[model samples]
Target chain A: MKRKFFSDRDKLEPALITIFAGVFSVLVGVGLIFIVSKDPVQSVRNFLLGPLLRTYNFYYLLIAMVPITFTGLALCIIYQLKYTSLIVDSSFYSGAIVATAIGINVSLPPGLHPAIAMLAAGLVGGLISLLPAILKIKWRANELVSSLMFNYVFYFIGSFVILYYLRDRNQTILASMPFQKSFSLPKLVENTQLHAGFIIAAVFVVLVSIFLFRTRWGYEIRITGANPKFAAYAGIPVATVALYAHFVSGFIGGIGGAVEMSGLYRAFIWQMNPSYAWDGVIVAMLARKNPKFVPLSALFLAYLRVGADFMSRRGDVAFEFITLLQGLIILILASDKIANYFKERRLKRAALSHDLAAQASSAGGQP
Target chain B: MIKFIISVFSSSNYWFIVLRSTAPILLVTLGAVITEQAGIKNMALEGSMLWAALTGVIVSAATGNVWAGFIAGIAAAVVIALILGLFALKLDANAVLCGVALNLFSTGGTVFVLFSLTGDKGISSSLASKTLPFIKIPFVENIPWVGKIFSGQNIIVWISVLAVVVIHIMLNKARVGVRIRAVGENLEAAKSAGISPNRIKFLTLAVSGVLAGMAGCFLSMGYTSNFTSGISAGRGYVANAAQVVAGGTAVGAIFASLIFGLTDAMATYLQNIGLPPELIQALPYVVTILGFVVITLIRDRKELIRKKKLFEKDRAKPLASGLGA
Candidate 1:
């Protein structure tokens, strides 16, 4: 039940395993590029170090990192409760729709306009996400299954809203009218798309970290997640905590979506947008499910994404290869058996050394 | 609305479309049902289908043979299943997360390969991909409404029906089926009873792989003529919910699949009738959530009632003397 040695190794094991998984997967990814690309070394170089070589790519990486960090922070919160509610993806999209609706229609002061839009987005996102949580809590329905389907539902509904109400008849392509100037997120950099959304992301990253580690509600949520039945017996309201987790997560997701839509996009055009929620999933896993580490993970993922973009354009490799790498990283990190195997191996080694030392001492004393 | 409903339901073509639409969902549901019976939720059902669909399209196009594509497609899904088993069973990865990983991999991997082959990101219309043909039943084609509903459907449609029966027999009447159920119900007890859970699970996954592969191939080759990116859409995910609604039975999956099919077909039919297409599109998911909740409530209520009876019986027995002192 207790380890007599390797406590230090046990403490460092998770981080070690994570680094190993990342490096191992990247190597496999490089090998894949080798197999597929005409010039393997150049392709690998572009994939590995392309984002850092240029300022434009660096800014793009930061811009890409913004929304994912928000969603990753949300993921860190919801996943703490250990319930598989994938409503973050839906809520993130809904959040953008809400932001667009408010920004285009509701007139407000310059600052207040974007604020109100973000608040509305968060509210709508939270409400959309609550459906699955409520179903799971009240009826014992599988939240994961319900939420997966709900993503498609919300997406179609949001598109309906966009198509009917917000469509720009002047546009040749399917897209919404641009938001009012007041709704635009304040730009922070001269030649880059960097905006106040990045600052907001930073703020939430710290806030979530504090909320999780310091607050009583956070403690309750953590305990509930760790062992719901035990937490219930110990007087925590497990269901309530779980519900709170979903709402908070959805709020973050919604806000993130709104920020991304307003800051980076020229208009409410969704055709080019990849699901930031999935990117957030990769970020969350890369962060080892820590809110404080979300920024780091987001940056790492952003770098990979930007690198892949460069490689695809310049080195004849597909960007989709990075997605395969991301999936590999998640699987390797989430492999409980693999992690446990390492831990077991270490413990066994420790036990054997302990036995050896004992036998040698006993022989020396007898002699 | 009532008239519209009745008119839609009254048509033999409506039933035919229902069965046809249900075929893919039912195939995936059967895939889900088998895995769920073995206490594994193959979240990779979506990924498996994607890989299969893409493989079927590309291979058939390359070989100019639909059957070759079909076999290769199924084989690809089986490989995914084996990979899932390797990570989930051998390495003790969280099966759900592993499934998610595979789904992600499949989505990206399929696109990567597709882009590599044809330099197209979305559709395979340029390729000479062959589709499975619909057969005309000579004798059954003579029947009136029944013929219209049941006869001359696509080959995969018949395979789906045949699959239902084969899977039903395999799960209910076969030894492996019993072993799988035992493993699902009580892994520890099954192991203690000398059953190898790993072996049973591997077999279950292979079967699931074949079913999901068929569903995937059906979407690309049988239902549609060409491979489109995300052709499976959310059917793979829907099958999971349907399998749950069916209570993990092959027979129950038919009715569960039909329910979704009815809603889905209604979505297609109801689009022109004053309702927004998006609303119609959203209807199936809303129905699924409702069905999921209602079934859970029913099951929970039944459990509560059964527990109350046991409690009452226990209360009727003589109480032991106080032992607190």
Candidate 2:
């Protein structure tokens, strides 16, 4: 007989795994502290407890999270459609590059440039995102493989544009000309360097949550993802929904790129960002692809990233110690069977106590 | 033109350069082909290859043996591939997500390790490492076209060719080949038949790792003298395309690899001919895009024909029923 106390679908597993991942991540953070600094313990405390120790660092962490939060929410749209096998990350990168390209090129008024850049990023990202969607629906091509390949194509194109065409010869390194100062998002805080992008990101997340939970189109996407054949039988147009999902995913991903570029750097910087698209994927995964939860997840990740960077600077440890820890955590999460073991033990003990109480009550009544 | 042909054949230098460039990509694609045939989608080949290359270089630098580096490279790739296989096949995580994670992990882990190792932020040098050497066959130069293509090539080239034959035979003629094909076709049916789909997936993934590892070895130790931080630059995706274009045949994979090799060579030639570097650089991706378009067209056409046949079957079915009634 199956035990009622330890059902397979218990939420406790996820909770335990989350705690384990957090602790493991901090442990790695401490190790990095030792590697980089003479006093590893102090370094760990500074990193884990340091950001919280100062109101300034905490604000910086929030500022750092602005772009990722936007990107992460945008990613959750595609993740919801179960088309994650396709364009989530590609959309994110394409958005950033498109936004950067326009932000650097256009000589717009200062107040309008940020908005224009964000929209441009979204549109570009969205358009590129549709390539794989079109292929998948029209020709039955594999979305995952094609989207993955398109990223490289975009990389080469972006690099070529940045290096030969747009590169600022005045600068020591290869990068774009200083983006028009007009493109900078308005500064919000007095003492800190945080921009208005954080507020914008938060607002966008709420809007996405509403669209995902309340809209008719969103319902169709959910139904289609849950069961395409059933959705088809129910008269939902699977092809149209799938295409729409890809298009929207691409659009938001693009916006993420634009916001990130405008908010963080004065100009288009690297040939590519450190796979922010992939980080968006990580965020989406941690949120279990929920549009509402992505903001929180993105912030958590951003905190870890910001803390790790600070830790490395303050101590002797390399930045890769964090990556190894992240990988370990992700690997554990991927294995549901292994992750659930910790939670199962807790439930087993709880059930044993309940049985013992029932036996003692019956014995007392008989005496 | 005659001089060009003669120059190609006469110079071991030309053959060596071509062989070196092609070997890693070919082996990597062959590994992808193994998984593709087993109906497993693999985008982690790039990550596996990168990881293997990093491991191979580090091991060779420490051990002072090219062969030891080669083994270490293969081992590194296999371990990564095994993790992917376990996640994809056993745990039911999305294969594509696993591929993405592997790529991310490889990129970050390698950079972290590189920073830790040499305190360099970019390419690692060949200061203390042993690189694989090109082998020249004795008196084979006396033969015809076979001699030109086969002799004085990287050992990886020979291994890749042998791999093609081995994979072809194992996939087509062996009992296990039948099971692998069955698993690819329908997992549920394979499970009902007691063929164990997960087992086949694991096996194919292992094979993929070995091939990808060799490819990494060829890349770091065979083709290039040193390893760069961003090595295996999207070769894995191309390998997937090669597998798809080849229609899951090992021989077809070789032909596809040749096409890619020729395209890469064409890009180099274009660069040499003073084509804009931007245009020249775009060549590989442009070619891949074209490949995707052409392949999609072909697949659509085939699907159309199949639909027509089905329609004919339905129409004939009505006439037969009417006559019988």
Candidate 3:
């Protein structure tokens, strides 16, 4: 019963591998800066320290983490359903449009308008996301492709709504009319643009963590994700679980879009996909699809992004250096061989000890 | 609307545009078919096309030769495919994750390199890039409508058409094609027969890279003369949809790509009308989703019929034997 340091079933092994992958990728990022920048040392210094040099930049980093936290949580919920649904992107757009329309049209009181808009946005997003899930359940269509194609459809519809229906005639740029002032998320930190969305994101992290781990429905979802056949055998309605998971995932993404727009901008201004949904995939992976870790992972990505922005401003290094680093990290982290090598070694040793103990015990019994 | 449709279809120029636009999607879809046949989901097609487009523009600009650009573009895409294979096959990484990473890398990395080379994040207009020349068939030019439909298209268009035939023959008849299909259908059987599945997958991805690279070159050198950020747009995904709708066959993919190409042409044509640009731009994607739904429904129905027939056979066997006795 002696515990080994590097056993196959050791809980720390994945964390160790992820940490090593992170360090390795950071080194790769620095090496890339060396190759690309004229002053590699200055660029590296700026990338590492620039985000913390100013309070505003630090706040900007926090602000950036808000949207990704929502997306990361959204991805965590849907990915557990065993579907690689890209409909989160469409849901984000649909939610933003719905929220914008409500914010502009509704005449609710100051305290109620933004809340109502966000709830409506979540509903729209959930409905939009349900299309692909239904398609998968009913017709056996590939969810990934359908969802991807749906993103473009929803994107255009959202754009058309903004351009044709909600256009502010006074402005030349293609944007919807500004939301009523009362509809915007209140500033949490004055003069730094940090808003209540951060608070909501944090709350979401806790709520999603509880939902995924604490409830009977959550247990059913986990079982369904781990094995659909087993869940079916266990009398869990697998289809219903999938539908609910998709809705919750899309609901989170929708709220993210609404909160992001309300927090940062006054109007509906996005003409293209903001790619937060794509970044969500990376965040979820970095967090290993754990809602509890989404905040940390989102912060890590946001910090890298803010640092990249600062480096681009101060040095010759392009902001894309972070993307390259992210790609390398994901490639390394998702590689099973890296983790499997240690796992197989530990398992082999355990098997050998098991065989030796069995043989010795049998010999002693015979004597 | 009817008049607009009639006017668009009656014009020979619309057909020419459809033919021209179909080339890239056809090439990419054929590449997708090859990789999918080898049981590798080719999600990195977009990244491959984007990287190839960048390399095509840069090398063509540097060398002032279009053929050199095409070769370099293919080489760059092959390198990407090799890396993808290294991760997905050798290291046992999730293919989808590797694909998403490659796509994000291509989007950012292309702009990063573009900025480094020309200090422009948007377009490579500063580079004096050479485009592939159009080829006019001498005898075909004499035919009235046929000539207009066939003559004076980009050379890549003809290559893509010829590729469909070559791929069809290769997939159905060639030794490598048989091995790829075997590996795709049953990895255990192929492995038990001493065939290396990983090697076959690597080769399949490499071949896919070549075709995707060619498609990328077509975008830069035939469709446009300079590289732009996101030049591949969603054509890579559309090609993938085409492959899926075609059931991963070369001929079917080509025809499906043509339908998408027609939608593209229609979108362009519709832009001149009073319709909003957003709706026009969404036509191809909407059509692709509809195509997928229809195809899935047909496949499901066929499967149900097959199951019913099997059940009927099982039920009839005992009764038929009893009657015979």
Q: Quick one: best DockQ, which candidate?
A: 1
Q: DockQ, per-model, please?
A: 0.71, 0.37, 0.64
Residues B51-146 of candidate 2: C-alpha lDDT, one tens digit per residue: 888888999999888889989999999998998988877776677777767876787777777766776647788346777877788888668765
Candidate 3, fnat value?
Answer: 0.68
Provide backbone clash counts, one per model. Answer: 0, 11, 0
Q: Say which docking band candidate 2 falls in.
A: acceptable
Report the Cα lDDT for residue B233, model 3: 84
List, residue by residue over A1-367, the lDDT tens digit for candidate 2. Answer: 3465346556546755766766776676566556645677766766676667778788888887776676677667777777754455666666666666677788899868889888877777778888887877887777777777677667666777677777789988777788778888877887677878888888888877777779988889889888999999999999998877777777777777777778778877775546666667667667766777777777777778777777767755566656665665566555655566655566777667776777664443321
What's the residue-level lDDT of B138 in candidate 1? Answer: 89
C-alpha positional error of residue A317 in candidate 2 after TM-score superposition, expressed in Å: 2.6
In model 2, where do residues sit more than 4 Å from their true spots? Answer: A1-16, A25-43, A54-56, A85-94, A335-367, B1-18, B140-151, B314-325
Error of 3 at A367 (Å): 33
Per-residue lDDT of model 1, residues A225-339, tens digit only: 8899999999998888888888989998999889987787657889533577877877887787788789888988888889899899996777898888888988898788667
Q: Whole-model lDDT for model 2 versus the true structure? A: 0.75
What TM-score against the true fold does each predicted structure earn? 0.95, 0.87, 0.95
Which residue pairs of candidate 1 clash? none
